[model samples]
Target: MPSAFLLIGIPGIENGATWTSLVFCVLYVLAILGNSALLYIIKTEESLHTPMFFFLSLLALNDLAFCSSTVPKTLGIFWMNGGLIDATSCLTQMFFVHCLSVIESGILTAMAYDRFVAICSPLRYSSVLTYSLLRKIALAILLRAIALIFPIPLLVRQLQYCGDNIVLHTYCDHMAVVNVACGDKRVDNVYGLVMSLFVTGFDLLFIGLSYSMILQAIFKMPTKDARQKAVGTCGSHISIIFIAYFSAIFSFLTYRFGQKTIPHSVHILSSNMFILFLPFWNPLVYGVKTKKIRQRVQRILFYNQSTFPPSRH
Candidate 1:
């Protein structure tokens, strides 16, 4: 077994690594600050303690995990040529990246269901998504992600890596690592495909169905203002959903099919962008679209007062 694998970050863009690293560094800092502030605001504001905000907090945390898992080493490779990642560390990173990806899909699905309940079945929203049930849903998301992704790294470990230990991407992506192993990779490939379809396909199907129901309910509302209000409520989540899924699908497709036609730099860069961009964008989208979160964030930054006024006894 190889001791450590080398990550050739953006193979053809070595000359521009300084600029690339700088851009990635700025984005990483922004993603961290944005998600941290989001988590903080959601945590402190009592009024924001609803099921929607609870799921947003989970998304923020997942974004943080997603970026932190890959960006530091990517920066190291880009700026300082530190691409060495040991077998265990690489597997650990791969596990978290893929696992959190699945979790994000699950969270988005849950949020869609939350919206469906709120817009389609308004009377039962609170009763259906009580905190107890919310905790259970969150736990299930975590468990399902782990159950699906845990076998991937194990499969990689079993393969004999007799060839070069250089991975042609920024992080220990499952297929990327498997490609470097000198063993039959059909099992790994099939499992990855099955898991991807099961997670992404399944989650997207439900999300689509939920939004279909939500749109149906919105149009049935008595007035245009009511329909607009319903859409307004879901705008931030829809923006986030698009950002997360679109970038992910683009990257996944490019890796699986565009390998021959797409430039290596494009592949590596897009993958990094997918991992980094969503975290940075999540807080911005929510803060700008969600009225309460926006006001609370503004107060935190521009004023020294608490997010909400204190309660009188």
Candidate 2:
């Protein structure tokens, strides 16, 4: 085990530290505030007590946890030059970051399935997605994420870190950390590739299938209003799914294959941006597109408007 690992923050852009830190700080603030407000509204609003909103609440919490794992440490590195992370802390960070990612993917898949069921068999949707079933789904998502990535830290821990302990990325990425270790990393590499493919690829494939089924069901509806209503219900979720997956996929591709074409700092920055952008934008996307959430947010922000002197009646 290494004493501490140093994170090289945004290599080749040393002068942009303050600017980078500012952007990160802003994103973190927005992500925290937005996710918290969404969670609060969902909890308090009886209208949002359905399975869709319940799944959304879980996603908000996951986004918060996901960003929490990386952004704070990243800020520490950029602002205070607090780059050196102990092995235990680094592994812990790695675990949660990847775990939350898997959880997010699973949640997205579950949401897609929810949409599919709602559209395809509206009559059975309520009975099919009971609270008990949702609990089981949540548990299964958590367990699957944990079980798949549980070996990552353990595998990395067995390797010796005699070489340069400096990590190029802002946070303790599993691959970056493993690459620096001084032992056989074939298992780690293979496992990582498999996990990445399975989690993202599998979830994405299912999401696509679910939506395809959903669209077919929507098209079969007799009226334009019915089709539009069905599509509208899925609009926010589809946006979130695309944004989150796009970022994650871009980051993954860049890290795995963009070293030659993409500038190192550019790759690093984009990777961090993906981590921050998803959580930061998720609430805004949902709040704007989901009419009920939008209305509730408006009411909460303008709680006193109804009592104003506009009632000159």
Candidate 3:
């Protein structure tokens, strides 16, 4: 086994990598700023202390970790030509990249459940989603991700890479790394497929079910205004869910099925976008769609402004 693996980073687009790095740099900065602002707002605003915002805070933190795990190394590979990642570090990155992805999926599912309870069982919302339960859910998400993803790196580590050591993607993606191995990899392939289906398929199924119930409840409301309000409440969550899952599904399918028809650079870009799209858009979606967050953000920006002219003037 080689000591380190080299990442070629967006094959067939080497010359444009610097420009691509600039775009990724901008998006990373935005993701950091947006999610950090979200965390700060949720932390400081007493009124925002509810199960919904609590889940949003967790999402923000996860987005921060998720984007951080891969973007820096991606930037290094693109700008600094530093793509040589030690085998252990490569596995470690692969683990976090996949683990955090599952964690994000779990968080989104929890958010879906929160909305389901809030809309469908409003009276029981407070009792059903206590902070204690939320904490337990958060812990379960962490443990579940660890349990499912831990074996992935171990499986990859067992492989003997007697062939090329260059990873085609920017980061040490699990399948990308596994594909570089020279020997039998049926177990790794099956495991990766099973885990992806289990995590993504399971979470997506629940999210869809939650929304179906939510919609049923909304439609059952007699007053049109009440129904609209209920739908409005779910708009941001729905948008975010769509963004997160669509990018993920697209990337997954493209990698698994479209490898022959799809251009390599397109696949790499889509994969990178899957990692970046949600983090960049989550806060923006919430800040614009959630009234309280929008109001709070406005107040924070214009808190010092006075309606009347200064007496000295």
Give the top-scoring candidate (lDDT): 3
lDDT tens per residue, model 3, 224-277? 999999999899888888888888888888888999999988988988888887
Clashes of 1: 0
TM-score of each prediction: 0.95, 0.95, 0.96
Q: Candidate 1 lDDT, tens digit per residue, 237-261?
A: 8888888888888888887889899
Report lDDT (CA) for all predictions: 0.91, 0.89, 0.91
User: For model 2, how big is the CA root-mean-square deviation?
Assistant: 2.3
Off by over 4 Å in 1: 305-313
Candidate 3 stretches greater than 4 Å from native: 304-313
Per-residue CA lDDT of model 2 for 1-313, tens digit only, reads 7778898788888887888799899999999999999999999889999999989999899989988989988898887889899879999999988888899899999999999999999999999999999999999999999999899999989987676788888998998898898888899988998899989989999999999999999989999999999989899888888888887887788778887898888877877877788889888888888888988988887987766677566
C-alpha displacement of 202 in model 1, angstroms?
Answer: 0.3
CA deviation > 4 Å runs, candidate 2: 304-313
Question: Candidate 3 lDDT (Cα, whole model)?
Answer: 0.91
